[model samples]
Target: MSFRTGKDFEFDPINGTNIIAREIGFKQTTFYNSTLTGTHKIDALGGFTVNWYGSFGILDQYIPLLQRLQYNQYTNLPGSPYLALISNGLSQKSGSVFYSTLSDYLYNAGGDISKSFTLFGQNKR
Candidate 1:
């Protein structure tokens, strides 16, 4: 299992704009294995095996509105005149969190036995 997170912050004194971002996530994995066998002269040979695995994780991002756009001579102006540019900037900051999980397992079992006897020439059972 593991956990991680990150954060960033910036300030523009001239434009009086501040940018902040943070992220956090975690991950976990599990595994299992087992085997069984029998040893006997008269008995058949038998064995079994199993394997299991699992994992999970999550991630998220956050951005302040002011940090979405580059504060400059053109972007600094607040009005519908730069609607396209401003909307683009907002889109950049718009982000969503994500999560994922996966789990699976495998199992196998088998057995075999052989015996030799004299019938006509040779026989096996």
Candidate 2:
């Protein structure tokens, strides 16, 4: 059995814009994955052997937040501390927050049976 987890953050920004934008945005995400697998062999009649194998896995993705806010450039400039920090919290302005989650699972199973034989002093299966 094995397990793994990860977290990520992004500063996606339109470096330089002439006009038509007054919105601030940020994004964050998290994920986790796990797996389990096993195999077994059994003895059967007449020298025949049987093999069984199976595996299972799962993955989850969570986007905690994709926060966005549009503050007036006329009131607070881009470099101002008010714009840099949530100085006044949310207000009556163009604002949006988006989030999502996803899950995936999979499984595999198989079996095989075979016997050995001798022909003309050579081994055959």
Candidate 3:
């Protein structure tokens, strides 16, 4: 325990924390017939994803021997030690919290067409 003065020392000890999480997504496509004169081709893709996170924690110290310095009612009460700075119970309860989320999607489409023509000599196609 650490000392804060002639009449005060480290007493209240507590811990707090939080957490989070998420999800993923994917997509793909294919096609046939690659040429206008011979055949045609096409492809596409689409998908969506989701994710979220949340966390919380708290610490509380409740001891009858411990005292709060803010209250004068215990100052001149005889055996009641003079506490300089402290909490009475719920007033000293400490905690933390966090929350987050993510959701989105992507889509794409593509196609192709082609043809061959004869030029001058030797079967150029």
Using lDDT as the measure, the top candidate is 2
Candidate number achieving the greatest TM-score relative to the actual structure? 2
lDDT scores in order: 0.38, 0.46, 0.28
Number of backbone collisions per candidate: 0, 0, 2
CA-only RMSD, every prediction: 12.5, 11.0, 20.3
Model 1 regions more than 4 Å off = 1-24, 43-96, 117-125
**Model 3 clashing residue pairs (backbone):** 33-40, 36-114
Q: How do the residues 34-96 of candidate 3 rate in per-residue lDDT, one tens digit apiece?
A: 222223232322222222223332323222233222312232245565333333345421121
Task: Tell how far residue 92 is off in model 2, in angstroms.
Answer: 24
Model 3 collision count: 2
Q: Candidate 1 on 25-105: residue-level lDDT in tens?
A: 454555565666554454333422233333333333332222222222232555423221233232443333345555555
Candidate 2 per-residue lDDT over residues 1-125, each given as its tens digit: 11212211122233322222233333343444444445444455547666667666666667665554432222224553322223354542335455667777777777777787799999886
| TM-score to true structure, per model | 0.31, 0.43, 0.20
Give the better candidate number (2 or 3) by TM-score.
2
Stretches off by above 4 angstroms in model 3 are 1-98, 122-125
| Residue 88's lDDT in candidate 3 | 38
